[model samples]
Target chain A: MNLYVKQTRSISFVPKSILAVLILSFFIQCFWHFTFTNFVAKRHALPEPPKASFIRLASLDDSVSAAKLLMLWLQAFDNQPGVSIPLKELNYDRVIQWMNLILEVDNKIQYPLLAAIRFYAEVQDEEKQRKMIAYVSNKFIEKPNERWATMAHAVYMAKHRVKDVALALDIAKLIRQYAKGDNVPYWAKQMEIFILEDMGELESAKIIIGGLLESGELQDAHQRKFLGQRLEEIEQRQKKGE
Target chain B: MNHNLLLTIAKYSIWEAIRDKFLIFILLGFITLFCISLFIGELAITEGLQMQSAILGSTLRLFSVFTMGLFVITSMVREFNDKGFELILSHPVPRSSYYFGKFCGFSVAALIISFMSFCCLCFYAPVNMSLLWSFSLFCELLIIIALSLLCLFSFNSITISFSVVTAFYILSRSIEAIQLISDSPIVASGSFSYKFINSMLDVIAYIIPDIYKFTQTDWLVYLPDVKTDILIVVSQTLIYVSLISCVALFDLYRKEL
Candidate 1:
């Protein structure tokens, strides 16, 4: 009888200890979750994008889908961890890294390059805007034929957003210089002339228009006519200034 | 080889998948995941439908793989457990026919799933791209099926076979990326450990199928070189499937059923 009682006591002791620990664990879990739920900082914590290697590995050989998914996540980041984080307060360098990492997964996808010009460039920070513009410009030079539109947008962002006409002109010229294929429409290079004109470099613009007209690269008669009129207009403006 | 007998066994395998309600599970799981994909698409700031198609395409691709693997592993394991496998061998059927028939049956089932996924996604993605994606997915499935048979015949346990097959799929899929990581100059370079790791990855990559080349989600978005991609998938599928099937055959012949 004593032996049976001792065994029962031993078994009961385990349950009692385990039950106590289990109940204690429930409280611990609740406390941690509550703290986490309440204490997340969104503004200071634009997420560090996952490593490129990790992205490629986790993608299961479907790098394109992985790239798109990361793009979507970055887009929705205005609302991260259930809070609305203003883009200006976020670290732009980290944002650039995320874009680069997404491209590393699948370079064929244009989403990241597009996002640099269209999405992240909206930040109120001038430096962030410039950084985004530079990101797009660099990406454009890498595959100028593929990313001409992005470069055009970057030119616009630099000229208007960054208020840096010189940088815009540089990027605008890169579109024509790097793109050798006919896939880049003729109009993409016209931005350079416009930016040069905007910068009050009429001689440069005339030289460009003359070179283009003589090169017979302008297939469309309308484009050729526009350049002719533009050259005369630049000459007239130069004469009046003189 | 008795063509009729081979076909009969193949038909039996199909019937087994049907009896297990494989199609029904596929349909229900696809619908649920697809709806979730749509929900995610709605959240896209732009390209809502493109997002939807990409998400659905990728998710369904993976779902098909998981279900197909589970079906192959569980169904074969059931045959082993029930002694049905031995029952077939009790007759005068060539063991190669048995293996080939089972392989053909699973492959057909995989094709059906691929078709279903294609049809559902056609309205969303470009037709050419969707077709290529489906074909490549089918080829990918063929490799997995062959690997599954090899794993089952070797391990003969559902748990181990499933685990091993899953690991192989993962490693093969990511092996290219793993190789890149090991060879990356960003880390401390020229170290003995780094060189060893790189060499090991290179050897492993040579053995495994470069699954990174298969079932590219980019194919859905971009206009792929259809002829070239098809050629790649076909050649790789043929080589890998043949090799894996050979290994499975060797393993099966050695067993005293």
Candidate 2:
């Protein structure tokens, strides 16, 4: 009876051995999460914000769940170990598929459109880049901010990498037509100037800046001063060329 | 609905859920994730609230759905394995009462757990919008649980029931996306094959409720009161759950225990 009592007493509120194992497991998991998992996450950080789909879904109508799934697929695709693969061998067909998936859900989303353009540009696939730019131009014709930002980025890429002034100028003209608002930021106006200067169209740069300054839309004193300096610099350069 | 019988069953189900060590595990996991969100918030520095709301809202929604599904299927399997359902049916209990009871039980259990998690969030980073999302999420989980019970009755095997129910939940979530592919220009203007695919997706779109509308965590960060939207969500859940329960009841009536 005493032995039985002693044996029962040994097992108190909780067993000591089980408590030790639980404590040890907690520390082990903490170490693993802080070290191993953290290291891997840092090595392969997501290029785009992860919950962008959830935000878009909240903001958009219908087809939002489809957008979420496509975002998940994009994240998974980006997380692939493709870094070791030769740059030339990196096929952009998957990128196109992911873009189409996102666009299919909500064509208004600028993130996927921008992502497609950047991915194709990175791989130096001018064909895919042109295709993406054309798609964005046609589909987002009404969304001026989205259209201008995307097309401007495309124009910048074209002038430097592809050396295609025609493509750059075409995008610039679209910007001129649709991106008209008092709210249009100065950076967008600068993009057109940058494209023209890159194409040696200093005359167009002078005219665009003159129009911007005259409109009084560059309301901030700093903006007005910056535009005045740029116009003067362009005039000096144009005269120097003559 | 048979209120008394329903209450009894639901009370029993809540008791079972409370006694479940698995539910405790899930609660612990939720708390851990919330802590991690706070840690991430610290790292973000400036946009800490936005980050915490997004992470906590999404994590809670996903984990709660998973917990509800696992709990329903496991409980059903245990009852079946032990001939517990047979013993209950051997009494004066009507099949509908038993079925409704199980649904009520699971919903209450889910409500309690979700409410507790919401309180935990309040302790860390309180937001009125989080409560709205959590409430809608509870409704969504209730609908999922009802559908799960239907699946459990339809398919005798727990594995098949769990898979089919989970698959159904996933498909419901992605139905909008499936419709998008079908309605794409290529499909709309393409050959007979594409039209046929589009037609099938149209039918599916009609069948599955658009759950994306209810599970939006974006509002948790931006909006103060999406009360009208939450009302619509709860009403939709009631209609869906009722339809699903009716089908489950019909199936259970015909089923040989």
In terms of lDDT, the best-performing candidate is: 1
List iRMS (one decimal) for every candidate.
10.6, 9.3
Give model 1's TM-score for chain A to 2 decimal places.
0.77
* TM accuracy, model 2: 0.60
* Residue B179 local lDDT, model 2: 61
- Clash count for each candidate, listed in order shown: 0, 1
Mark the regions of model 1 whose C-alpha exceeds 4 Å error after superposition.
Answer: A1-44, A47-51, A159-170, A176-180, A195-204, A232-242, B45-54, B184-200
Q: Write down the TM-score of model 1's second chain.
A: 0.96
Candidate 1 lDDT over residue span A1-242, tens digit each: 12112223545657677888999999999999988767656454666777877887787767777888888888777776657877777677887888888888778778777777788897778888888887888787788888898888888888888888999898888886887578877778788998888889999999988998998888889989988999999999999999
lDDT of 1 at B62: 83
Tens digits of per-residue lDDT, candidate 1, B110-157, equal 988888888877867887788888888899898888898899999988
Fnat score for model 1: 0.62
For candidate 1, state the interface root-mean-square deviation in angstroms to 1 decimal: 10.6
